[model samples]
Structures are given as structure tokens and as C-alpha cells.
Target: MEEYKIRIVKTIQYIDSHIDADLSLEKVSEVSAYSPFHFHRIFKLVTGETLQSYIIRKKIEKSALHLAVHKNMEIKDIYWDLGFSNHSVFCKTFKKYYGLAPTEFRRSAPEKFHKILQIQSKNGQVDTVFSQYICNIENLLNWTKMNLKIEVKEMPEMNLASVMSLGIANVEPSFNLLIDWAKKKSLFPRENVKMISVYHDSCKITPLDKVRIHACMLLDERLSKQEGEVFPETIDGGKYIVGSGEVTLDDFEQCWVSMFLWMNENNYSTRRTFPYEIYHTNFKEHPEGKMIVDFCIPVH
Candidate 1:
């Protein structure tokens, strides 16, 4: 079952990282190295949805994030890029997810996403409770102004040895696994070896229980190999909105909000890429349990 978890997590990560991969059931099952039936069973057991359903759910959630934040991205771009067969299917799916038409979602973005990317769930009960703090934390901009020297910088491309961790709750366990493995391979020649994480799905849009994050260790150089739980992958070098600060786990959400506010005020939009964070110092090792980190938002 643990092996099944690895296979499913790796397969999902592969699909997200590639972005252009064929999404047909046959291809996905093949990628998982399991028979179609077995793949479906395992994937559903791990993710709580069928593979196709999971894919569609992610696409729809991502689309909602776009519609909610980036007014410049056309609906057609969202629908087509996410692999919807036609406009009709796109509209139907959009309504099914948000209980409104795509245009309606955009027109009502303010009401839909209360503040920045805060989304109210269909029932308007659960998400409303989760997002209550957004309004309360209006001074995150002050936090940013005081604590972070924000900059737009070019990040270098990286080849990473990564461990896939499901559920955001087990972040420490995931990093522990990666660090223990890295010690065996002697990759940490210095105390400052970079520790990075790429969250495959946004927690605001996706359920916290189902979110997937890759716990990635930066290798000293470009090398590629597949070694059991560890796999090789490259992240793109691009312009990013970056800020480094001493933040506890509690400050992360606020920091992220401040960055988004900063981006919006400064006329930058998200570049349709996965964002990442660089841990300058490990929070677990710190006496005060604060992460000295640079949260990088990929942008044009």
C-alpha cells in the first residue's frame, strides 16, 4: 500500500509537471506501471476520486483560480488549456464546480473570492469559516513592508531529487524522509544546502486533505536518475516575485497574502506556473521554530 502511494503520487506529479502529457486513462495507467483496473483502484483509494475525475477536478479548480484572480486570461484559454472538449463542456463543468457560469464567476469575482484568492465553498459554510481571517489580516502589507525586502528576481533552473508527500499535514515527515535519504547520498556538503518544496495544488482551491506537495532537495548539479522513491526532474528558471523573511509556520499564509497584494498593487500577474519557496534555514532546527525563507512566486 505504501508502494502504491509512491506510485500514485509520482504519477500525479509527473502529470502536473509535464502539463502537456496525454491525459487518456490508458496513458496514465501505463505511466503508473499498473494495469488500468489496478491503477484506477489505487488512485481512487489514495486520492478519493477516480483518476479522470481527479484530473477534471484539478483543471476546474485551477480554472477557478484564474477566473478569480487574473482578469486578463480569457475563458477560452482556461477551458482549452485544461483540455475540455468544447465550450459547452467547459461551461457545464464550470457551472458544476462553482454553481455559476464562467462569465458569471468572473463578473462576480469580488463576491466569489471574498478578498484575494479566498473562495467560498458551494454550501458557503466551510470555506467562509476558513477565509474569515483574510479580512482580519489587512495589515499583512505592513508585515511585508517591515520584514521583507521584496524583489523580482530571475531564478536559476534546477534539477532536483524529490520526495512526493500527500496531504499538507505531514510536511515535517516528508522533509525528514528526504533529508535522511540525502544524508545517505552525501548531498549535504554544507549546512546551507537548499531545501525547496513545490505544492502541486493550491490549498485555497483544493481540499487540504487532498493537496499534494513535492519535498525537493536541490542537487549541486544537473544529474538525472530514478532511484526507487527518489526521481529526477527539472524546474524552470524564470522571473519571480520573491521575498525572504523570518516566518513561523503561522506567518506563511499571511506572507503569501501580502505577496499577492504586493503583486496586485505593483501590476504583476501570476505566470501560470507552480510557485515555490526556498528555505534558507530549516524551521525544525531553529530555536524559535521559524523558517528563514524566500517565497517565490513565478511571474512574467
Candidate 2:
């Protein structure tokens, strides 16, 4: 156990030192004197984060340090210095991780971000960063107060082809499968990506297994199956009260939680029937990850 702890510490030190380099799992495991096969599992067991997530998070931490220390630098320079290939990539990943753009974040806390804010003072000064905390129920009530109309629409039942996977959301590999399947069959035009979650327990508070997600599509008679695949199954459908709103990356968590709360309060409950998310816009094109999607929940 002591030896394992030492290995983890060494790994962390190496990561810190090589923040600007491409640090892969194989290289990290070799440096830490651990086998590549066991490295990810052991690292997760010890640190509660995967190597990729850890590296990205640490990069953000280092970026925060640099931002506080050198407020005059350009955001593009910061992006490159932090090892991102380009400004846009850096912005996307950063927004996903931090929920805000670099400019917006700094603007919100100018004092903490001002490089000379502390040194100019006769006595050592402390500055606080503007931070936003998520209030699940309160924020939802506020949004609903916008009197966002309860839009009712009847959606026709349709068959859908789907693939199931573990994990909470889409990432590279799973998305690759979704895209390849869609492109080969040209499913992107007529059909659409419907992310469905059947929650046996609260995903907000419970373990991951309590959440099951299926990447689905609405199929017309034009849809056909590929070889070695079974018949397309009908995504059991029903009436749904749909509510949608736009959320910038910074407000995603608060907005999502609030929407759920609103649904619960308004008698919109999941019936193990029609429960899904229709992603309407492209996430990559949206600045600060602005996305508009409809949440469909069945009600009694």
C-alpha cells in the first residue's frame, strides 16, 4: 500500500512537470513503474478520476494559475501555452469543463484575475474569484417563472435502431459508432439522434448504473436494417409534454436540474414510456456550448 501511494505521487509529479507535453497512459504507466493494463483501474481506484479526465482537469488548474499570474496575456496565447492545438479546441474543452468561456470567467472576477491587484497594495491582499454555485430547485423555479409556455404536440410512434453502452454521456468512441452507422445509411437527414434515459433511480444523486441511456433514432418505412443486425425495434412511444430552453455552457447544470424540478412540480413524470432528449442543434458550432434541446416527459 505504501509503495502504491508512492507510485501515485510519482505519477502526479510527472504529470505536473509534463503539462505541456503529450502524456499518454502508456508513458505514464512506464514512468510510474506500473503495468499499462492495470494503470487506469488502479489510478481510478486511488484518485477517483481517469487519466484523460485528470490530465484535462490539471491543465485547467494550471491555466487558472497562469490566468491569475499573468492577466495581460492574450487568451489565444494562454490556449497554446496550455498545450491545446488551437484556440477553438481549447475553448470547447474549457467550456465543457468549466461551464464558462475564459473571457466570461475572467470578466466575472476581474479583481482576482488582475495580475497586479495584490502586488500594488501596501499590505498583502487577497482577491476572490466570482464563482457560481448551482441551486437545483431555486434556479428551476426562476426559469419556469419566465412563463415558458407548455407546448403540447403529438409525436407519431416510430421504430428505431439503437446501440446501448455504459457511461453517462457521449464521448469519442461511442460517437464514432453513432456517426459511422448514420453516415453509411444516411440516417442523419431523415432520422435524428434521440438520447434516452430510463432512470430506475435518481441520476442526480445515485450511482451510474441507476441510469440507462440508449442512443436512438426515429425511423420511417424508408429505414432498413444492415446484415447480421436484428429487426429494428419500435421505441415504445406515448404522449409527452415537451419543454425546451437554450443554455450556455455556464448555465447547463443549473438549467438542467431546474428543468427536471419543474417537470416534477408540474405533474410531468416519467412513465417508463416516452422519455427522451431530442438534440436539435449542433454543439460544436455554438459559442460557449449553447444548445437548444427538448426534454420529453410523460405525464399522468
Candidate 3:
């Protein structure tokens, strides 16, 4: 898994740097040190998207933001600069992905795309943190980087309905079991119920097959303890450094490392508590390309 993750990081860096060039799977596999045939398999397992699909989406997505925010440039110039080769191709792809022509999208959604670019830029700070730690030839060759910043804030304690699952590493299974358990116990009230997951072990340090996960749902005034062997633990909510981003399974290590660095830099500490995840989006609702999970950690 470590080798796979390393290769995945290399692939992302290669695409990021060569966004203007003709980036093909064959070329990417060569750059990432993988066999051409196995490249797609590993890419899918790690990032949940094909290399071509991800690159195209990212290019369109970023170019959309550039067009939306940069009013000084003509829409045709932005399309040409994005390597679309022709106006018709650019317009077709842009409208297919964003549901509007370049001009229409720029006029109607500049503010929305601007905020996305801001968040994405903030998220790219992981590369800066990596430069502080690693110094090696592979680091140069791979350019593995993550960029993210988090802020600290306080939250009040909330009740939760939780069910411990034996399949700890599989997050989807854990959440499914928790929801089913809640349903069986008739404790899934509609109001004020928020889904949460606690990360008890570091995936980078722990084996991916055995990492621990806890699935939970916030309780409201109407919720009461159900009859079963289910356990409820208090999550002492106080000051917490909140970190949120969409990351692939392979990039989980970089995400945690960045968060730890952010916490230490900000002088936040905790004696004993597992950081929790508020799964704001699911894979079924959004394409795997856009799924996001927000991570929250309590601190002193």
C-alpha cells in the first residue's frame, strides 16, 4: 500500500505540472514508475477515477475558475490557453461539464468559482509542509505535496448513537452497520442527527487492513438510549482545529501529516481523544471525483 500510495502521489504531481501538455496514461505510467497496463488499475483503486477522466475534469474545473474570476482576459483566450485547440471543442466540453457556455458561466457564477479556487489554493499548501520534512532524490522526482490549513474553534458536547463494528478498516461497512443498528433500535430520529466517524489509528502508521474506525450519529432531545450491547462514549467537545478537504484513500497519509503539522504550528494539544470525521458528502450523491469528508479534532 505504501508503494502504491507513493506512485499515486507521483502521478498527481506529474499531471499537475504537465497540465498544458498532452498527458496520456502511457506517459503518466512511465513517469510514475508503473507498468502501462497496471496503471489504470492502481489509479482507480487509489483515486477512484481514471487518469484521463480526472485530468480532464481538473483542467476544465480550474479553467472554469480562471475564466470566471479573470475578467481582464477574453473568454476565447482562456479557452485557447487551456489547450482546447478550437472554440467549438472548448465550448462543448465547458457546457457539458458546467451546464453553461463560457460567457454565461462567467457572468452567472464568478463568485462561486472564485471561492472554490480560494479553497483549492488553501488546500494545496501540503507541498509547503513536505518541503520542510523530506530531502531526497525520490522527493524531487515525485514532487509529492499536500496543501491545507486549518483553524481552531470551540464546539459544545453533543450526544451520539454509535455502534462498534468488527470491520474497522472498511469505513463504508462501519457506517452501514451503524445506520442499520440505529434503525433496528428505532433511535434514528430525523432532527439534529449528524453523522460522525472517529479515527482511532493513523493509516500511515497502522496497517490499512486493520485501522480502527468508529461510526456515530449525533443525538437530539428526542433520542433515548436503545436496548442493546451498543456503547455510547462522550466526545468532549471544546476547542478544536477543524480541517476539511476531499482526498483519495491513497492521499490519507498526507492529509493527516498536514493536519498534525497545522495543529503543532498553532500550539494545539490533546492528551487523549480520537479526531472525528463529519462525512458531509457520499460517493453515491457526487461522483467519486468530488467527494469530500470534513475532519475535526478537539484540542486544548
Q: Write the per-residue lDDT of candidate 1 for residues 1-300, one digit (tens) a residue.
A: 134334555577666544435787788888877656445544554455677787887688778878888889988888888888899999998899889999998888774463544444564333443243232333343566777778999998888888888789876687788778788888864767988998778765567878888888888776567777777767888899998899898878666756665565566877777888888887778898997889989887
Please name the candidate that would achieve the greatest TM-score relative to the true structure: 1
Pairs clashing within candidate 2? none
Q: How big is the positional error of residue 242 in model 3, measured in Å on the Cα after superposition?
A: 0.6
lDDT for each of the candidates?
0.73, 0.57, 0.64
Candidate 1: deviation at residue 245, Å?
A: 0.5
lDDT of 3 by residue, 1-300 (tens): 144445566677678767778788788889877656445544544454668777878778767878877877887777776677888888888889989998888788746667653433344534642332233323422422333446777877767666665345566776677777778767664554578877777543466777776677776542455536345756777888776776655555445544554454455675477788765555465556444666677778
Candidates' TM-scores?
0.54, 0.44, 0.46
Task: Give the Cα error of residue 248 in candidate 1, in Å.
Answer: 0.5
Clashing pairs counted in every model: 0, 0, 6
Question: Candidate 2 residues 54-103, lDDT tens each?
Answer: 89887876676566566798888887877888878877887787688777
Candidate 2 Cα errors over 4 Å, as ranges: 1-138, 145-149, 169-172, 189-202, 222-231, 248-256
RMSD (CA, angstroms), candidate 2: 16.1
Q: Candidate 1: TM-score? A: 0.54
Better of 1 and 3 by lDDT: 1
